[model samples]
Target: MRRFLDKLYLVSGALAAIFTVGVLVAVTMSIVTRQLGVHIGGLNAYAGYSMAAAGFLALAHTFKSGEHIRVTLILSSLPAKGRMRLDLCALVIACIIAGNLCWFSFKLVLDSYAYNDISTSDDATPLWIPQISMAVGTLIFFIAILDETIRRYKGIPETIQSEEAHYE
Candidate 1:
């Protein structure tokens, strides 16, 4: 199960990288088309969608790897026991927030699908197409938070380091 979850994060991260590249490619193509006097409708909107997907899909992997920005100054000052306790508390709060985000994101995807919502852009892209990626990312991020919370509750040491030296 651990391996599976890790693989999921890795895959999500890779997909995000792909989407990020897609954004660059789209913009480049748009520029090339403009240079050639070829009109491409909705290029900007497509690039926007790619950017959204890239950001959303990277969330879980970033969080798991401790790459997300965190204020560790207080944690660093605490004793081992105190730090552990505070970390667990923070994880619990994060889980709650991530859970709420996942629920609403999923609902947004469902509502978009049910309403047959389409973007107002020239491409008329279906909104659910992008919403699905957002919802999946949120769900995985929630899972990652819950996983860390469970590990902490079980007295397992976290991989996140509070020491300044660990930053390098």
Candidate 2:
């Protein structure tokens, strides 16, 4: 299960990178077409979509990597036991927030699909198509937070420092 979860996070991160590249491609194509006196209706919209996807998809991986910002000023000041307790409390709160976000994001996607919502852009893109990424990303992020919460509850040492060290 650990291996599978890790792989899931890795895959999500890779997808985020791909979407980032997609944004670049879309913007570049838009620029080139405009310079050639051709107006592409959807390139800008596509770029915006890709940018959003990249941001959303990167969330779980970033959190897992400990790349998300932390208030170390307070955490670091605490003793080991106190810090662990505080960290656990924080993780629980984060889980609640992430879970709510995941639920709402998925609900939004479903609502958009049900309503046949289309973007007002010239391309008339289906909103659900782009919203799927947000839903999936939020779900993954919630899972990651829950996983951490469980690990902490079980008294498992955090791997964040080691993971960061490995990268360095």
Candidate 3:
């Protein structure tokens, strides 16, 4: 089961990396095109969309790796047991908050799809596309947080270790 979850995280991270590359490629092409005195009508819109997707897709993996910003000044001052307790508390709160975010984001995506929402840009890209990716990222982040919470509850050491592991 841990392997399966690890695989899922890897897949999601790969998707995000691919999407990030897509955005970078699109931007590079856009720059070249503009240099050649060409105005690509949809390149800007597409790059924006790709960036949004990449950010959303990477969120879950980022959270899992403790790559999210956190206030550690106070938490870091605690003893080992106290820090562990705080970490557990933080994970539980994150599970609750990220869970709600995931639920609401999923519903938002569905609502956008139902409305057939589209960008007002000339590209008229479907808004649901990015929203869907963002929702998936949020959902995955919640699941990862739940796993972390379980690990913390189960007294899994190193579940939240390293100062650099605290945030991305």
Candidate 4:
């Protein structure tokens, strides 16, 4: 499970980087094209799509890396039992929300695939590509949340401990 989650993190991070680069390149090219008075493409729309991909796809990996923000003020002052209990409750809620997101995204991917959907832009990029990224990332994020919930239940003292146990 740890291995799978790690792979998901790596994949999502890679995809996010790709999207970020795409956004940069697209914007620059669009600027150059407009300045030179040439018909290049829809720069704004393409960048929007790439940004969406990067932002949504990086969510799960970010959560897995403990990069997600939390109101740790109260959590930090609580006793161990209370903290763990609150963590468990938060995880449960996250799982439910992420699970729903995955379900809806899966259906979206299916619908797009069924209709052979394409964006109504000059590029006409296939819609499934983005949907798949969103769906998979959300699913992996939920899995990471579930993993953390289990670890909290098991009293994980630090991320280093989880890393060591993950390999051993």
* Model 2, span 91-122: residue lDDT tens: 99999999999999999999999999999999
Residue pairs whose backbone atoms clash in candidate 2: none
Expressed as tens digits, the lDDT of each residue in 1-168 for candidate 3 is: 998987788788899999999999989999999999988778888888888788877877877676778788877899989998998898899899999999999999889899999988778877888788889988888888898889878988754456655345
lDDT tens string, model 4, 30-104?
989988999865677789888888988888777776667677778778998898788789888988988898889
Count the clashes in each prediction.
0, 0, 4, 0
Candidate 4 residue runs with Cα over 4 Å from true position: 158-168
How many Å off is the CA of 147 in candidate 1?
A: 0.7
lDDT, residue 99, model 4? 85
Candidate number with the higher TM-score (2 or 4): 2
Model 3 ranges with Cα > 4 A deviation: 164-168
Instruction: Give the range where candidate 2 is weakest over 10 consecutive residues by summed lDDT.
Output: 158-167
List the global CA lDDT of all models: 0.91, 0.93, 0.84, 0.80
Candidate ranking under TM-score, highest first, comes to 2, 1, 3, 4
In model 4, the clashing pairs are none
Please report how far candidate 1 places residue 156 from its true position, in Å: 1.3
